[model samples]
Target: MIICGTNAGSPRCWMLVNDTVLTDVQGNGQIASASDISPPYPSQKSISLPSDGSLYSAMSSVTGHPGSIRRTFGSQKLLKTENVWLLNPQFAGAAIMPSTLKYKEEIYFFFSELNKTARVDEEPYRARIGRICTVDEGGIKALLADSWTTFMKARVMCGAGNTQQQYNNMKQAVVLTAQDKRAGVLYGLFSNAWGRTVICAYSIEDIDQAFSTSKLKGYSSPFVGSRPGMCVRKNSTTGGHNDIKNLGVIRYHPEIEDVIRPVGVAPLDLPTDDQITHAVADIVLAVNDEHYSVLYLGT
Candidate 1:
């Protein structure tokens, strides 16, 4: 699936299925596209935010690609839809990155906003990430009075106060939430000035209480790691951490057809911090023909 947008045009998303591109029945790309391109069951519509046009135009011109395009059913098609909108009302100057994650019945989107000058200076130039809850069937409604009803405000993180470094250019976020059978928590992997780092944040359900007041803690790894992608699964047969197994960083090898693959094992008990920091790259969760999978987005 692909999502694209520009200042002049509406933001859109497309689905690639069986080599053909499929568009939404209504043709709005933002509303009909899947948040996660890979999965047990790929959804038709997911959450999407508007774009500021400057970056999207540049990306479109360089790649010679439209605002949105995807392969599905052996063909390519452009997605156009207007099912979702940002509730914050203050994101007109923001440029959304290409990474997003779905968790806790909501789609969390990450975006970087540039001020009027288009520079990441101290003048309100920084990355801003936010989340919008999924609206039920009848489309989005208006909020109390003047507020837009469909979208919810997102909680943003800046490398300030407690953390040593600031998160200057955060691009993506992958959220792993514990299921009912296991402990409930949210783990996030994001980029900062130093490099990529893994932080354990509160689950999406607790965002209202955790924002600003809460700080995300880092998880120890066994690789020279940054930009970690994570997923959780139940292993009833195994008993520790409620059988909550953590899939470590993806390993890239020359022989592999795909560039990267997940390092499947439990790393919670690894004693030394040196064991962490092995491989550093951005990871994304995607699905193939058979099952759930993960992919490293960076080289």
Candidate 2:
């Protein structure tokens, strides 16, 4: 089965029943009807299907319209992001990362948002990496009732810290994870406003660590229970309410204070200037019983 977005950016499920014919998963004998999905002006979109069979989508936000991330078509409850979570975002990519626990798995969304309040010297575009737990079932009725409670995002820095060479626009991203899912790397394609493009690599473990420990933006008080944005087992009787309490905390503060910087604190010094348009990365097993990373760039 294959899942994709229609020209209008609605999600559709397709299956190849034979060599000469393709049909919807339901075998309706016609192109899958998109009447059930509704996301506005989603010409440019990012979609991901996790192990849970849910489809996650993020749409491009045009002028005066809000972009959104939503989950559907799974046994679990449907979830969507709050309108205030994303600010004029242009989606770049999406991927699912495994976890030690089933419910701790995560779906990551990559994008760059317009900084409407940037100063004359500051860049107007900022790259971001947002993620949510695969088992997230939304929040409490009094809080983000139908919204994600484990949503948390961190700023992605692709250049040297606070330097002029920083590339603020994230054009693409791909992840390569280990067999245990404990170690991984995120390869991101970033471009500056002037169109200079560069590649940065970040350790997935580092990112996970930051989100697990960083303080919420504009929030400093001690947490009442487990930290916000954590993946708690919903069946645990002792801390089931932890997820609900977490919802209220992140509903008001989803952005983390710690910024996610690339490994080695800089972008890769690749000897190429051929106008890289996209990047894909993979792990190859070597004869030495070790794995090596290979990155492919498109011009």
Candidate 3:
């Protein structure tokens, strides 16, 4: 397994180890990277590795620079989010999902962004789920050459639409997908400003449809060709005029207009408190040839 953390609170480090290396008294793990750099105190960080063996990481710090999502350790070009994409974000979770098309595979990241400019009575933390195509090769040379071209984010709601009972702070999340990776549910643990916690379940299919159909946040023009976040084969289309235009569209407007509300428009009515700190979910095949989801929440 690979592990990443800070060495002395300065530069980050990474190591690869196994059971033997971890259990031996004198065995030391191999150094993946001694001085991989990142923000200080990455307590709110999420990491995932896709099927193609590429590492994706998102990190944010309370007292450091802005948060960022990055893709690394692959044959493809390096990709990262622009500084403005995330604002005081606290990453909760990340996972990869396969698509029907190989090039359309994507990764989803969960986080809550703090709105520093919010009024005293307004909600400060807004939960969000962001996605990016796994095959994204950055952008054209003149535009977002090092940034993800298919990055899109949508607001996540954990309560009734436009209600005051919404939980705006996302603390943890776990996804349970079917064997085909198409049908699934995303369970998000959310908390309100009053320290109350609740579990909200969202349909993966609904989230996917939102991302695939929602309009760009500020773009009023109807797309005549391929949409902004649609993944296309690189070899089929060069970084030409239309490609560059789409890249610019996503660079300036990564957030979608649609909000991803939880299934049934409300949080789960479980008799739980704020003590829950972690969550895990799995799919169980029943004897009746059906699949069921078993969720475990830990304190």
Candidate 4:
């Protein structure tokens, strides 16, 4: 289902379902009815079924705390459901992008790490985007594996032109290209300090693999542009130069040296001789349809 107006609530979340009206059950919950209700929304309400039976509403809570899943389901009657913490709490301050696809029975989460160290000049802390994978199973087994598996410990950092500084304080978003179904590539959009310029990076492996082998050879270059965000479409009936079209939004600075106007996505195989540029916004991928989606918590 399309979830609209998620960023428009008082707390900025979508409230209506299929155009049906819903009443807030409590401060953190909502209830739906066949008809309308008066003020002081019900904390618990029953939903009518086709057979004239009733189904109770399932509530989800999001505290926006570290290691918290923004969405969950809990029984109103039993109160026995447990909350799922997908990431380690140590990475609590990190900006969570969102969730993407689940492959090989693993669910991937993308996020950006903000550099919190104090500086004499007081520059804004920079961010680096990465991905982590956890088991899809919901049980002690999954939680244990997520918490302790060494294989899960692998991570990839965005690189800047063979220098760490290129991606320093980088803000990025990742998405899977539908063009290469056999070996989908993860595309990243990032920016340096001042957000005046942006860069693009790509990896053959999924987010998890990209994070593991970021330092290895064959990674894409840190292409420069204004600010950029990725637009990815899989299986486009609309024909294009490539089976997949990786589009980006970018703005250019006229005064900066080596700064190019209007950026574009060249074929992945094309020579790097001034064919590409950077992006403007964070690229977002669908969690279920794509391999992964990464969310950012801070600006």
Winning candidate number (lDDT): 2
Give one digit per residue, the lDDT tens place, for model 4 in 1-299: 11222222222223454578643333433333212111112322211111011121122222342222211211211111122222222121122222243232222223333335636654344332222222221112212211212122123334433343443333333444443232434444444454533334444344433333333222233534211111122211132322112111011110111111111232122223331243222436575666353433232
Q: Candidate 2's C-alpha lDDT?
A: 0.78
lDDT by residue for model 3 (235-286), tens = 2136777776777788889999999998899988776665677888888789
Q: Which has the higher lDDT value, candidate number 1 or candidate number 2? A: 2
For every model shown, what is its TM-score relative to the native structure?
Answer: 0.34, 0.86, 0.87, 0.37
In model 3, what is the error at residue 192, expressed in angstroms?
0.6
lDDT of 1 at 226: 20
Scored against the true structure, residue 135 in model 4 reaches a CA lDDT of 23
Can you write out model 1's per-residue Cα lDDT over 1-299, one digit (the tens) per residue?
A: 44333313334444455558665423332232231221112121222333321011111001222222111111112221121222111121211212233222333344444334444533333443433222211111221121111122233444433444544333444444343322223333334444544332333444433322232223333323222112112112232232112111111110111111112211122233331222222334446544332322332
| lDDT (C-alpha, whole model) for all candidates | 0.28, 0.78, 0.76, 0.27
Q: What lDDT score is found at residue 138 in candidate 4?
A: 19
Query: Relative to the unseen true structure, what is the Cα RMSD of model 4?
Result: 17.9
- Highest TM-score, which number? 3
- Sorted by TM-score, highest first, which candidate order results? 3, 2, 4, 1
Give stretches of model 4 more than 4 Å off: 1-18, 23-107, 116-135, 138-160, 172-174, 179-182, 206-299
TM-score of 4: 0.37
Per-residue error for 234 in candidate 3, Å, reads 1.6
